[model samples]
Target: MFTSDYKYKDYIQEIYKTFSPLSWLLKIFSLDSLSRGNKQKFASSYWALAKGALTFTILAAINLFTIYYKFTWFYVELIISVKYADAVQMIYDLCQYFVDLYFVYKYGSDVFYEYIRQYAYIDGMFGMEYYGSIRRRLINVMIFMISMWFSSSLSDYVIWAIGFGLMSTTFFSMAYIYMFIKILTNLHVTVHIMHIESRLRVLGDLIQECYCSSVSCTARIEDAVIKKNWFYTIKTKTSKSQLYPLKKISYVNSNEVKWLSRCYLLLTEQVNFINRMFGMRPVTAPCWTKGLSQGEGLPIITTLGRRDGYRTRYEKMQAAYKDLLSLVQSQPINFHMAHFMRLDYPLLVSICSVFVTYTIILIQSI
Candidate 1:
């Protein structure tokens, strides 16, 4: 899932798929067109995004300014004197939109190189199909998010189209940022975790084969030959001080072991990086330890990650693939809604919830 043989455009395509419309907007920001453009001839890739965000932020500020200037605006009689809550909430959301956009601008290149260029560049459909299954895990969640947004939007501005229209552009700005965070997170999961899953499965098989194959019997045969040679040496020397031979053990699958060891180390490194990227434990593959150890027990895996207090790497990976993605459960989209939020579900829910919560007041006031 995270191969590096392909070019950067593949990532653009994948990122593009998350939401093509937003990708198009980001492109105007030079996400693709000016990727190779120098600042001499072009501005920063985030220029368009920054300009767009600023425009919306300005609009929201004006609305907020108008609301604040009214003085009585804070206490809209929307129930028991909510006081500045709605105004404050909208201001907070707009600020959040700024923060989200800033993260995108700063990390834009690093993310492209790390995910799209390095990990998300899969070569074939066989791997993609498996990865796609894991990716779709969030589809239900996405559907729920979209539906909630629509319903809340429908209910919030039933009679106040003018007010809603003023607020709509501001909210759209935040939604764009939300969508960007989502696409980035999904790419993270699809490339890192799913790729880990696929690699670990392959590793488990390799480990199982290395351990289960006949390494022990070959040693026995070598021992028998050594004994025979020892007898012949004694006869040939036939006297005096005896010479002794030291037995040196070797892996029958030494080449295979070396290859597997390299593969395992690389795979674990990848897992560690991904886990750390989102502030999870450095050794997260072990989250699947119990599941992988079920039914089949370990069979002579010395190079496993067990000594460092993690389960066998392969097993952990197996479990990781089967387990529910726990990167950001409280979030509708992983890591996107993490921490503070002014815009996104928090803001959307705030606007709608507050609107509905005081809908009765609106009816009375109107």
Candidate 2:
């Protein structure tokens, strides 16, 4: 429903068109195919093996040189560079690349693997294809960011890319290298989102099951009790002292009801936590009925609260549960916003503004 403005199928086609051919060569270890979970064989088939081996042999010389330059000679170049700041930047870039590489290899792939599993497992409560679309867009954004690093590396390290008359060979050569960096880093974040959603979905399913089972069992017990009371009235005495019609018509255990209510409240709390994290405005059912009432756990009781009060409590909890489902269905996904947890957009802007201000001061002082 939220994808009305987004053309997912078109973008999926674009991804296939752009990446299908070189996927084998690009994912030397089949990481891309592995990341997709299933139904793709671009990485491990006989043709993929033959083509990847042939291409690696073809690019072996340059690949060797590039790897050595990145891990070793780049740092050595850093110490000798005249512009220390940009040199430091190159160091940071390489470090970010390595750290992101480790994260992607170790957790990112597992995350996507689990994401696909959970998406299918939960029958697609996975929400917006944040796994697919945002990941691609985030990689695009990071590729733009990488351009900054590449430009600095060219000016500072003088190795990653070098210019020629009309075009640069190094620039073309390292395109896949940077693209690899972008994919890994973006997937790292994508996997994290998937993992969290997977856990939340599991918890939600458990709570729903409990709610169903408990409510059904209570209904059966209440039915049996009412029948026994009717038989007693027919067989025995009915006097003014005897309350013959009085039977426990409702056997919804108070503990079970309250526990479910608490579960519902906790579910909403978690949903709001994720919403807050993603910079989404709270899906407030009046901020959880005014935080379960003013200051304490109990609301101030008024005489008007006399009409089927348990039903009102049940309705509130039920609303919270449904709201959690809707929030899950919406799946907040803003790349810049998602990147910063515990800090909303205003705070992020303020931090950036302050940093820029201080940088200007330091530059003027220099």
Candidate 1 residue-pair clash tally: 2
**TM-score top scorer:** 1
Q: Model 1: how far is 357 from its true place, Å?
A: 20
Local accuracy of candidate 1 as per-residue lDDT tens digits, 225-254: 222223211112111111111222222234
Q: Let me know the TM-score candidate 2 reaches against the reference structure.
A: 0.34
The total of clashing pairs for model 2 equals: 0
Tell me the TM-score of each prediction against the true structure. 0.43, 0.34
- RMSD to the true structure for each prediction, in A, is 16.5, 17.5
Predicted candidate 2 versus true structure: per-residue lDDT over 44-158, tens digit per residue: 3444335434544444454455545544634464333333443344444444444333333333333434433333322222222223443455457556665766676456434
Best by lDDT: 1
- For all candidates, what are the clash counts? 2, 0
Stretches of candidate 2 off by over 4 Å are 1-82, 124-340, 343-352, 356-366
